[model samples]
Target: MKRLIPLILETLDRGLTRVNPLVAAALWHLRHPTRRGVLKACAALPLLFVLYVLVLIPFTPGIGDIRKAKIEQPARILSADGKLLAEFKPSNREWVKLKDISPNVVNALIATEDHRFYQHFGLDWRRTASAALHTFSGDRQGGSTITQQLARNLYPDEIGRAPTLTRKLKEAITAFKIEALYTKDEILETYLNTVPFLYNAYGIEMAARTYFDKSASELNVLESATLAGMLKGNSYYNPVLNPERALQRRNTVLAQMVKFGKLTPAAYQTLSKKPLRIDFERQTEPPGPAPHFAQQLRKWLAAWADRNDYNLYSDGLVVRTTIDSRLQTMATQAVILQGNQLQGIANAAWGSRAGCSNGKDLLATFLRETPDYRAAKDTGLSDDDALKRVSANRGLVQSVCESKTRVQADFLAMDPRNGQIRAWVGSRDFSQDPFDHVQQARRQPGSTFKPFVYAAAFEAGAKPSDTLLDQPVEIQLAGGEVWRPGDEDEPSERPITLRDGLAYSRNRITAQLMQTVGPNKVARLARAMGVRDSPLEAVPSLALGTSPVTLKEMVSAYGTIANLGGYVEPVMVTRIEDRNGEVLADFAPTPPQQELSADAA
Candidate 1:
């Protein structure tokens, strides 16, 4: 038993010896580190330090030159000898260097945007830390250095940030690269050019030109301050929306300039003495009469740019328009007064009336409610309600509605000899909404159709004094459609002269004349007379202008008639050139075609 006990104790002693060596080996590994591991830690610490100091520490500005081609927009509306009517700057985006952006303007930007601009590197660590602390506390804050902003501005897609560590790291790397490449002045210049000023208004140059009607170099201190103040919040400080607040913000920028030593104390005092009291309402030039001309000019310029494969907004192009200012004024006024009055008379007869017999009271109501009625929407009212409104005041509403008492006028004047549109007014007010009626809207011509009908009759061998039956008649069509034509003032049968028929706008006589001349002959005559879209089947009622036609076609046809049958295609553009004075195109007169006899035309 004793020998067995001794064997057991020896086996246990060997097991304990083996366990101690293994435990010692594990303890040695826990206490000691590898040289490779130590070397890696040393390398990583300096790498992080270097990244903070060299890359993340400094703010860098942006740099890139615009690769834009310069072209000249076409000069539309020209005189016989190629004299210009109006000059246009359609989508003109010129890059004026920062040097030209007055020193006051630069100072204003620096004062309001970055007071400690010169002292900070690519990133202002203190401001960054403050922003971080604020953000951590659920407060919104931004203190991006100019360089970081420049990076974001230059590479919009790449530098889009969401206040994440990854974005910050990327910003730091890009900022360092930008700073290394671009000079401070170049950075500032790029920043100003790329920064957004208003809705779709990118760059300080565009803002200056758009708001002040001047170049950046021509801006005064007040204007500079006002522009600089917009960088923070363009919509919030819009001069058009919040003039008082905008002025106050601008003055604050000026004050900051004085505090930052960018402005002389005396200069600041003078500039800050009073706000630039710009009367938003009255501080504008009266718009000229070439609204339609201007609109067409823009369209042509856009098409020209597209044809040349150029960016209209980015390409710096100077466009000249063809608007005879004097003629435009005359034509616009004529159309406004004469057209409105004619429309009024038409309204008095055909419009819905409340069954009132008094014409004076009806006209009064028309005059009173015309503006509102024109401004109101055409939809949402049921047919019954509309009729009720039209019938109110015993036919007053109906009478007023008949004559076009509301504002709707279109004027188009062109040289019949050359087809150069000299003057045009699309609507009475371009400021209201520039839906150009001159070229866009097609309205019923009423008696205006008589001229073409008469010309057709003359071409068909009917003389000016030819007699036509003015008796009431019913027109029957092959499709079984029946239409009874009547005169406005006469109910009894009568005979009328061709000239008198047109002068009186008699429906029955004109309808009979159409039938005698043949519908095909009249259609052919209408087309040859410059009616771009010819009237449907010389319908019996076409003589009364039941058809729709554009002002351009009407004016073109009328001008041809006045000029004795000579027809020319209207030319809105006269010349096109490049910024370097190179001619691109010069408009030539389209040959005149004789469409009607001398007496007929």
Candidate 2:
């Protein structure tokens, strides 16, 4: 009765004559003794919430300034004549204007992804309320508009969350902020540039160029529809994976476009019926006379990528190699034909003996397991370990036995003045065994060593026409190894001029001359003649091609002579550009430096 008397007094004080009990309670509170405390709590609650919103839980700038994204400079492959050979890949996000994109495309995206894009101030409250109702009713529909998508792609993790009330409030604030900050077209453009289209493929520019080998501006109605359809589920509707699903998705976009009046019904029907035609022309490899050059270039690129910390497959850096395409082609064909001829001769010569045939078959079988068909079995080698176990002399004998083709061939050609690799053949064929015999292989120089020996002699005051005897002679070595040197002309001892010694590649004459001119002196001369590896010491058989030499060193020596004793270091890349169109590296061929006397070399 006292409480009721107090409530009646409070209701009377608030002048609530016809108040219901609930209204009476509100009136009582309005006039109650603790009203000041209740009002203060209400005011403080909103202030604390505002402080939380403004201070700690405000919108964050995600992903930093996108303009600072790192880019690999696209590699530009060029011909010897400086013509563009090929571009490694076209760039993603090469922008196109809204006018350039089909109106239907723009309409379809708006209708499907964000219907109220034009009308809203970056956010729609009515839709937000409906989304809240839908979420409570167990339907989780994302109300992200095209602008929201762009904001997210350019800066994900901002408005995208579990659709909490606080997050929704923040998203609305941020979306409004973005709308105020950027224009409608600007937002749309950003969306086009950052959207992912397919697996490992990003942006509409790359999508258009990759799928149709065309530009976004060049996308026809059907093609635009296809691209639009990819947005629903890029991997699922990818034309490359399931064309039927892609076509159906595309038709859906087209139908939406017609319903929106962006595309006429007639236009949609025509586009839907047209064949999906695209020229899937694979990128052409540079034409080269020396395919071995390509193999070497590939190896060099692999190493370069490792050194430069680039993923060759994923990092979008373009690599340009120094190769004359015409020369590469010539070199490849020459090796292929030569390998075939030699392989035929080897098979025929060893065909009569069952043991040799079996060995050859074993080699052939091993080679067939590889990509190279030219790695025909060499019956001359007893086993894989035989070459390692035997002396060089025995190895030479085995090489000769296997030399039915007597045609061991290896070559290296480079631009003498600039050091650009023009042609290199490792083993007459890359597809045969694919072992890069040129760069990573060592082989006997045969008579090729004589030129270096003679160059040494000439540098030591011997003339080209100097006298030397090409007679057969047995000589005792200082190291107790005895050697008998002979010329192919053979048998009778004959006096031949040093000119003839070099021209005919006579062994005895060169050996006898080595005796006259000490072996150490000859080795020094070989070093001067471009033998980069340590020169072999003078020995009894030094004149008979005992030391091994790489094709690079051999060719450098030959080219030094060809260039009138001028030597130039080889270079491959002319320049490397960064993605932002900045020159990261620029290379120019330097003039030749003199390494040897023209007269001696």
Q: How many steric overlaps are in each model, in order?
A: 31, 19
**TM-scores, one per candidate:** 0.58, 0.49
Candidate 1 lDDT over residue span 25-83, tens digit each: 54444345588767876889978877765663333223332112112233333433444
Regions more than 4 Å wrong, model 2: 1-74, 83-322, 352-410, 427-432, 533-540, 577-584
lDDT of 1 at 480: 98
Judged by lDDT against the true structure, how good is candidate 2? 0.65
Q: Model 2 over residues 1-601: C-alpha lDDT tens digits?
A: 9699877776475675465667767665665649686888798999988887676344544222333222323345555656454444333345566677656556767766777788888776677678768988999776766766665565456556664666655555555666776678866766776688754456676677778887777777787788888887888987876888888888888888777667898888788886655433222234334445555665666687688776443355544456666775577677668876766676566663221332444434433343222222243444443433322334333443453333445666688777777656777644444566776777667778777777777777888777765466778876777788775566455567888888877788888877777777766666665677745756646676688777887777777788877877767666655544466556788877676678987
Which 10 consecutive residues of model 2 have the lowest summed lDDT?
63-72
| Candidate 1: segments with Cα more than 4 A from true spot | 1-108, 115-230, 236-286, 311-326, 329-410, 427-435, 457-467, 476-506, 517-525, 533-538, 559-567, 592-600
